[model samples]
Target: MSDIYDLITKRMDLLTREKEVFADNILRSSVPGEREKVIKFKNLVTHGGATPKAQATGLKSTNKNHLSLSTHLGSTRMTTKKTDSDVSLSGNTINAEDQLRKINDATTKYYEMTSLYQSYMRRHNTVITGR
Candidate 1:
C-alpha cells in the first residue's frame, strides 16, 4: 500500500525517532544540578541577615599597650633574598606518549562514526529528503 513518498516519510519517522531517543536519554540522565544551584544561590542571598556595616581602618581591642599589639608590630619585618642574575624555568609539558595516544584514539573514533553515518545516508538515499 505504501508508495515511494510514503516510504520516504516512514524513513523520516525512523530518523526522527532515533533523534528523540538520544534527546530523551540526555534529559533523563541529567542530574538535578540546576535545582541544586538555584537552592544554593537562594540560601547565599538570604543568609546575610541584618549585619551592620563595618568601618574602614578598624583596630582590634583599641589598646596600643596590649602585649599582643607589640608582638604583632615586631612580626612585621622585611627580609632580603638573593636576586636571580639569570632567569630559568621549566614549564609543565604534556607527556608526548599520552598526547599521541589520545590523538590516535580520537581520530579512530571520529572516522568510525563518520563512516557509519555516511553508510546510513547512502543506503537510505532514496528515502532521505536531500541527496
Candidate 2:
C-alpha cells in the first residue's frame, strides 16, 4: 500500500513539473514571433508609402522629352495631389501607425511574460538543485 501511494505521488509530481516546463517553453517561443511582428510593423510605419507604381513610372521614364514641359508640370501636380489623397486614404483604411503601436504593446507584453517565465525557471532550478 505504501509503495502504490508513493508511486502515485511521484507520478503526480512529474506531471506537474512537465506542465510547468511546457508553459515556460511556450512563453519563450512566443517572444521571437512577437519580435518579428514588431519589426515588420515598425518598418511599415516608417517606410510604407501610398504612391502607386504608375505615378512612379512617370518619374522613371527614359525619354526626357516624352512629355511637353506644360504636360509634365501638370502631371507632377496631379501626382502630388494623388499622393496626398492616397496617404489620407491609407491612414483611414490601414492605420499603419496604430497597428505599429499595437505591435509594440504586444512585444512589451511578450517580453514581460518571457521574463516572468525565466524567473520562475530560475526559482524552480534553485529548488531542485538546493543551490
Best by lDDT: 2
- After superposing candidate 1, which stretches have Cα over 4 Å from the reference? 1-93, 126-131
TM-score of each: 0.28, 0.32
Candidate that would win on TM-score: 2
Candidate 2's C-alpha lDDT? Answer: 0.38
Local distance difference test values of all predictions, in order: 0.35, 0.38
Q: Candidate 1 at residue 71, lDDT?
A: 27
Q: Write one digit per residue (lDDT tens) for candidate 1, span 57-112.
A: 23244575654322222222222223332212432222334334544554565556
Model 1 steric clash pairs? none
Candidate 2 segments exceeding 4 Å error: 1-92
In candidate 2, the residue pairs with backbone N, CA or C atoms under 3 Å apart (3 or more residues apart, or in different chains) clash, namely: none
Candidate 1's C-alpha lDDT? 0.35
